[model samples]
Target chain A: MISNKQILLLTSLLIFSAASILFSLLSGSVDITLAEIAGSILSAETNLNSQVLHQIRIPRIQAAFVTGGLLALSGAIMQVLLRNPLADPYILGISGGAAVGALSAILLGASGFWLSNAAFAGALFSIFLVFGIANKFGDWSVTRLLLTGVVVSAGWGAVINILLTTSSTNNVQSMLFWLMGDLSQSRVNLAHYLLLIAGLAGGLLLSRSLNVFIRGELLAVSLGVNVQALRLLLFFSASVFTATAVTIAGSVGFVGLIVPHMLRLLGARDHRFLIPSCILLGGSFLVLADSLARTIVAPQQLPVGVVTAVIGVPAFILILRSTIRK
Target chain B: MATLHIQSLTLEVAKKTLCRDLNLQIQQNESWCLLGRNGAGKTTLLHSLIKQRVIDEGSVLLDGTDIADLKQRELARKIGILFQQGIEALPATVFETVMLGRHPHLQSLLLDNEKDIEIAEQALAVFELDSLKARPVDTLSGGELQRLALALLLAQAPEIFLLDEPSNHLDVAFQIKLLTVLTDKVREASASLIMATHDINLASRFCDNIILLLEGGEALVGKCSDVLTEENLSKAYGCPIQSVHSGEHRLFYPA
Candidate 1:
């Protein structure tokens, strides 16, 4: 059953998400005042402010929000799937594979759309590689899967280093930006939104079984959950979510790891509440971080990944401390 | 009524035969105890009965249907198992943990109904854990955790219960109380019970049938009066055992 406190938390997160989106839109290089934004929206004005809002800010905000939602949702699912609290979307080599793809693309003079496609293809390749090796014996244990993922991730890291070492200085800077997660050139379409919504809906549908699953695999099996089927679904779903997010944002860090932990610390441990709350809180967190990234240096933009870690580490520490005190 | 029939079953672990040609018929409302020392295959036998473990040979049937043919959900409705180890520490509350027992019955994508909540609450009350329903499971003590596990099994209400070392970590008083409650529940529901344990006295006191697993894959299975003798237990345990009759009850001790 959903408690009143959980309902309140969800409501607060929804409000926070809206406010963050608004803040990101209003505070850019050329700061548009509240009245100017309102006038542009209320009337069909072709003002410069409106042009910037429609063409640039709107798409970037959507990309950031959806990417964050996808990452956090994947992280939550991964923690349950691996039954390890430290497990994030990237722990399974998806991000490393994507990094290798994007780095290689940068070296080959591929920019924009091709770079994104390369990253996505790399992510898929890593997903299958890890899965194929782990399930080679027909029945894959959790330990085997985790070990396989870790080893594959290490291999990807080595390839990424080689690409970085051989690249020219100018190419290296762009490669570093991509590695640190830049959203300046990021955009989203209808499909990204649909994927986020589908992921949320699917997560909610599986929430109850996930609650039982967290206890243990054997316990879930005894409780009539199709453990093998549920595990396969979780693996692929988390992989797809991670792949899509990395493709859009280039390995934005900490949002996935911190958002779900924050929700759990705030007493929303149930999957039904945890899943939706992860989307709301994660999207808002990234929006706020990206806003700070854009405005803190004003035009000389820091990477969103740096901003996320800068904000996320201290916030996570505070939450962890308070929970331990309780 | 539900029944379990094991036909000409054989089991091995790491090339060592655990049992051979073991036939057992567990009828409705019966209580069976598996008594053996460490590595005596009590747990292995229990797992095999529920199809959780692969048997070397033969079939295990639930009401004349082979268990291998049944889906996991179908099997869950008819049988429940309590593992030997304590539950892992998680962020779930006591009530939420017990409510998981209703998972097999609840439909997908639907919230638990009022009846499911009531059942969970009643299970908590039965274990004297009603006051701690909202407490996190990780905070429970060993004895309390054991009681909680038993309460969850009660809520599950399967036709057959297979427990591995069910009495582990329980105090003397709670041990008797909980075992009595289990036997009473089994009798009232006309369900069967198969428990594996090292406590000979407890097995003699609670079970109607005894299965003594001995060395080299041999076994002795019969009524409690016939199978729970000093000679049988000593042979099964690889040690001398002495028994004394006290007020219509026979208690065994190491000699």
Candidate 2:
């Protein structure tokens, strides 16, 4: 039954998404008009204004969209994979894994490729560790999985702290800043790579399996779903999506944990709708948050991570309240 | 036509032999009821047939094909079993829970097709669960969920139905309703059904044959009238028993 409410919500989300994209393009530090954005795309543009609009601001906008979309997608998938509403990339220990990797690179004086590499490696390692510990205890119990994650996260956090303390002040500042998250250094090419590979692979492969999964494990298995294989695939896909988000935007939190639940609350539980909705809404939310961070105190940019938390916390609470009321 | 042959099947768990040298054959359209007191291995034997528990010796064959040769999916298509108070992980809708029975028939990525829906709908209608199709299964009453579970088994459309205490947690009306539906399904599909039940009367009224499980892995397998005797019931249940028979129906009760 395709209700009118569903149609209305979908249409409004789309309209809001278009408006948010347009608004993000217009509200950067070096202001560019809507016409200029269009003109920059249309023209064979090499002029200063066109260069700023096309080369710098456009890439940043795209990066924000990709990162935001992925984090939310990961969150939604994690919820179903873990069989808990509170589950997200962070709760599944991906954030801790990525954080460990990013912190290690910073401590080691690594730059460029080493940063993203360390982040990805750390994320995968953490997931594998949690999977191993949980599996070792016989069945894949949810409590055991989360508890193991909590323990590992504590250990990883302690290690990151030790590394930070032992490092020079300059290194510490950069490490701390990355931990807080930033969007200033985002590259279009890297964002494109992360979005295309992780998004397509995770979204397509897992979406169908997720429908089976949401029905519950026994039913999923009875339906010829290989539970073990699917869980591993889900962990790997979500880890990759999460790690890429961290590497690009530097550990933007809560978006990966919150947005998917919002989509579910809005009556889009089917993965086909949920997967895309998370992607679009996540990207849009981050781009808007990033724009506000850049311009809220113009000429003195706040970290996008800080902006996200500030906006995300209140909005998350609002969503939570509305969800509970419903 | 389907035939299940258990030849000298024995099951031992934790160094305790629950059943030993159990030879039985259930052919197409046959219905068998297992009557026993608690801990008599009726449940264990039922579980063994589904491979949920290992058989210590011999083989279980469907149509002379050993169960070991058939993969789980293929075997599932031929046999559907329901456990009492089965696991429910989430609040799955009645339609979705029933649709899960179609899993063995589905391909990797293809969504549920018209045939699958038709089968699910028919199963739902058979158990009078069509109105509750969209309702969350967890919200269902025990009797309703039991009916829904039966609908799920019907959706599988297996040749053999193995039930363990299928009447548990059901009211008298639901119990009678379940027995009637099961009997109707067996008749219409020409399917073999084996149910392990505590109610001797229910078994005598509905079953074509009865297996009386006594203590220490001993059992008497024969017609319902022969197996449901007071002597066997007293020996099996460790209690004085009597039989009441009127017309074609016979019932056993503790004296």
Candidate 3:
């Protein structure tokens, strides 16, 4: 028998996703009618306003949806991989490492085309470093992995701070803005970016072997799961997804840390359900958060990160409290 | 038929020899009990037989194939292991936990089919655990959990059953019940049942064969009547042990 809360959550996510896309199209700084926006998406050449709407608004909306969705999915997968309720996307130092890479590339005057690449490489490298340190201790203890992740994150944080201190004022502002997470500057094709997200999402869904891993590494190995290979593969894919999200929209907070657990607390433990729910809800939540950030201050805008944290913390606390009672 | 051959198996952990130069065999249709005092490596020897603990300098062969060469699932298919203690912290229902026995049989993507459910239900029926099927495992009393573990092992449908201290947490009645149920299974399936126990009397009464393990790295494997002598018990336990026999059953008492 299915719980009513699960049905409610699934229903709410679908409704929110539809509403978020509509809001994404309608409620930007400059208002555009729904009909005109539809016309712009359908026939860009027929309407002058269509060109501005298609180029500027559509990508921003898609970026918010995809990045938010993927980050939440990554958070869910990572928590299960570590078997710790508190684990999230940043627990492996992926975001911290990506920040260092993105900032370094920016400060060193790299072209816009290379920014995402540098960030992806940095995230991969930091995850490898953390994994190496954890391996040195001879077991994948959650406490060891968490401590190692913190140390690696601190190391990357120091590097980014040092770069910021030495860089010119102009570069520092850009670095700070990116680190704060802004989707206003993203202009990538939605189809291309969605493909990467879908692939990583597919890989995570295929990790049903992870169910055995949840029992313990020894149990997983004894159950015919290649524990080491599966661990490395999961680490690599989760980091790539996080790095791509970072590259696309700077570094958004809270969504990656909060949404997957929220789904789980709402009774979706199976990854097949949890992962897709995260995608839909995460994308919709972030888009809604971004929209709120734009409109809350009227003519001025707050950072989307600030909006998400403000909205996410209380809900997260409520979920945490309820889960403990359970 | 399942046969296990352990040739000179030794295990050392943290520079202490847990088991040294141990050799044993279990043929089909045999119920063998390992008798030892605390820290005498009875459980370690059982673990070695099941391939849970890697042997240092020997080979464990099952049905003529090296255990190390078998895939974990394949090994599990041939041998069912009941741990010394129940694993807590998982909020698994008795049915779900018992269904885990089918892990070796079912693919990860597929749900437990009717055949798997039938096997699990049969196991539950054998152990008389159908009434407690929906209870969370952690909530069960020690005896109930032990019975549940036995049911799980039965569901695994293994050719050999390896149990570590199956009677440790049980009451006298449950202990006898567990042993009788296991002996019955061994008889019915033509499977070898190997158990580690500190209760020599229970071992002698219920087991067809007994291996008396001494603390100083010696193992005496033979019939129960041959191994449970006062001299051997006292030497292995490092204390004065007196024995009394009633019919085929022998009881060991500390003097």
Show model 1 residue runs off by greater than 4 Å: B107-110
The two-chain DockQ for each candidate, comma-separated, is 0.70, 0.33, 0.35
Clashing pairs in 2: A69-A283
Please provide, for model 3 over A22-124, each residue's C-alpha lDDT reduced to its tens digit, 9 standing for 90 to 100.
8877886677898887777776365656755677667778889888977887787687677787777787788888888889899878836787778778887
Model 1, B1-255: lDDT tens digits are: 799998988999999888888998999999999998899798888877666678889999999999889888888889998889857767688998998888877554646688888988998898899999999999999988888898888888899999898899998898899999888988999999999999999999999898889898888999999999999998998899999999978989999
TM-score, structure 3 vs. true = 0.87
* Better candidate number, 2 or 3, judged by lDDT: 2
Better of 1 and 2 by TM-score: 1
**TM-score of chain A considered alone, across all candidate predictions:** 0.98, 0.89, 0.86
Docking category of candidate 1: medium
On TM-score, the leading prediction is: 1
Native-vs-model 1 lDDT? Answer: 0.90
The candidate 1 chain A region of ten consecutive residues with least summed lDDT is A217-226
| Tens-digit lDDT track of model 2 for B1-255 | 789998888777677666678888998888899988887888788867766556889899988999878766677778777776553735557887787777667544535577888899999998899999888776888778888878888888888988888888788888998789888987799998998999888887778788887777777888876677788889989999997778877767789
Which residue pairs clash in candidate 3? Answer: none
Better of 1 and 2 by DockQ: 1
Cα lDDT tens digits for candidate 2, A1-326: 23466567667777877888888778867867778778888989678888877776778888888888878888887788777887877776667788888888887788768887888788888878888988896677667877888788888888878888888999888887778777877765764665655675667556656776786665555444567677777777776777778878788877877788777767777675678778778888888888898889988787788888899889878977986795
